[model samples]
Target: MKFKLLAAAVSSIALASPVFADLVLPWMSYRTGPYAVAGIPLADGYADYLTMLNERDGGIGGVPVRLLECETGYNTEKGVECYESTKAEGSLVYHPLSTGITYQLIPKVTADGIALHSMGYGRTSAANGKIFSNIFNYPANYWTAASAGVNYLLNENSGSLEGKHIALLYHNSAYGKEPIRTLEGLSEKHGFELTLIPVDHPGQEQKSQWLQIRRERPDYVIMWGFGVMNQVAIQEAANIRFPMENFIGNWWAGAEHDVIPAGDVANGYKSLVMNDTGSEFSIYDDIQKYVVASGKAAGAGDNLGTVMYNRSLYMAFLTHMAILKAQELAGTSDISQAEMIKGMEALEITDAMMAEYGLANIGPAFSVSCENHGGPGLGAVSQWDASAGKWNLVSDYLVADMDLINPLIQADSLAFAQENNITERCN
Candidate 1:
């Protein structure tokens, strides 16, 4: 299905006069690229939620909300172009799902005074709301996953991680760097030795990264790669007799395409999961009935409830809910970027919302403010059982030992503030 697009550039202001006050959200998606297998469903799920909300609930805050999607194909330049091209039509926020793009457009968002809703999967340090005024990495970040991954290993070893050697095979980019800072901190604090292996972008040919793993003999390997990198990590781990069960992947590294490509060889390899999987979620039923059944589902019925599908849907939901909260505060349908940012800062995803969405709550119960972007460090450890063909949650909504890492976040934020000359003002 071809989604609608507004050709005007974000910086262009061709005033045709505001016909009806509608909230505009511009999306940058990678629907046709190496990451498309994961990107397409996620894009569809995200767009469909906005469409569903508009159709069923009469848009957010009783004002029509339009989602204009521009494909980036995982290209950072294309993402920036799309952002520049879409921001002028009164865009309430820019939700670029790429960590690379987040890094690129972060400064631009601050200059433009528009919000960047980067809830998950971006520079973990961007979670410092004060330093990065316009960038919001809510709910959780990559460092949370890193700390959780370390905690999972410790838990598995019966509550102590003194001499454990943990290896990380990650995509060689800003996104991959998201977890390294926290992992290093965790290692130093917990007395675990850490080894990092970088896999170049698109992450396909990794015969060597795995060889290093074989030689290092890490107690467990954590994967921070995506797309071809994920399957390659699994295959290489399997080839080196590294015991698939012991290898863990960050959220982006674990998905259907990531595993299916490894064929049956990728059984029992575990990864940290951001949310629930499978087509049994109640939201999927609504999508099937309201969107797909009505021939309005973004992509196809087969993509429903997959990892990308759920992630996209979840991201859009968070954005929509933020808008709802913003409207409650703004008390008007014509919500400006500043008002929306205020609403975003005040959002609280209650258990009732989780029940309404047929999604489980994985959290530390969060409310964003101007100073703090991340709500809570809530996440779970999920294991893939080859026999079951499903991700099993091994732990609950556990909070990572933030006390051990907040200092690092602060130090890094300070460094970033100094490097960028970021001046923050709290309301």
Candidate 2:
């Protein structure tokens, strides 16, 4: 597979100083294939943010950043190839945006001694950083998203879901299967009848799944879909005249690209959100001024402020924070992958820090530690208003019930450790 590299020019000051080496950040990007609709904005946001830092702030901690974009086309094999090829380029951290790619890179990244910032899409169990020390999925994970979705439902139904028939229409992949265990546990706890419907890859066709949904008449549908799958599912629901208000999607299913194609029929569809949507934040203004306005933007400037794009911007911001923390701890702008891991583990995002970073009220502030790679696991529900052409937050920040999720994480992480002969690092 051929890899595409996007290298930012080093600052003249850094070029003048022979001792300065750019900090490398490798993006395992996927801007093609079935998921390109979703991938393009995310990749663009990530690259543009790093570009903005380089252009406006002179890079993080005054050290120039070298961001390498290696396209995986959302393919697992290509993702691994990207990682292998870039791992030797003084790579400080890896962000494999695809859940499938993240799964494949877990062991390899661990062995390679680089930090993996899976964010919201990787193994939910990696939230237990004791076993998965080099992996970080802060702010929220799938299990947390699942619980928050259910919590929103419970609130919607007046705090009781007993006997409510809920259908889960998910894409058939590792990413889609993630919420099953959590939803199952929630079903047993709340006395709701759970139905699972799987849509094959690319997710363009889901006639049969919608037929089942029509036959069973589930009171609510929780979508675990991505890319074209999301739009198709929304259209199918509208075709059946299912009440759009009763449908909700996971975070991955809630972007602008998902609902815009369906138009007004997608109105009232809701989804979980770990970050604020739209470009109302100050950071976005900076992005507009420094990146897009200057024509340094990665993709089309039309998607400059959409949900998925902003989400990726937030992801890049958090990654930047971690890198800054790593540099601060090491007392050097240029640090190794091991130092990046230390920075990620010790990273904390407070309210003040969020304001400083121009991210106030975007999401909950949380800290990463040795024992917890994932942050506070906080999320909120956002409803799609097709007429308005944007998403609006309808619920306050909902905290995940760790009481229910923690046990599952413990068991899964323990199993992983035993199978890999790994020991807990911070226990």
Give residue 52's lDDT in candidate 2 (0 to 100). 92
Q: What are the lDDT scores of the predictions, listed in order?
A: 0.80, 0.90
Q: Give TM-scores for every candidate, taking all chains together and pairing residue i with residue i.
A: 0.91, 0.95
lDDT by residue (1-427, candidate 1, tens digit) is 1232344532244465344577898889888988887788888888888878777778876788888899999889999999889988889888888888988998888888898987667667777787887888888788887887887788889988899898888889777877887888788888989998899977778888877888889989988888888877787777788888888888888887778766667888787866766766676666666677788877766777677777777888788888888888977767898888888878888877877756656233567877778767667777776666777777876678789768877888889899988775674
Task: State which candidate has the highest TM-score.
Answer: 2
Model 2 CA deviation exceeding 4 Å by range: 1-18
Clashes of each: 5, 0
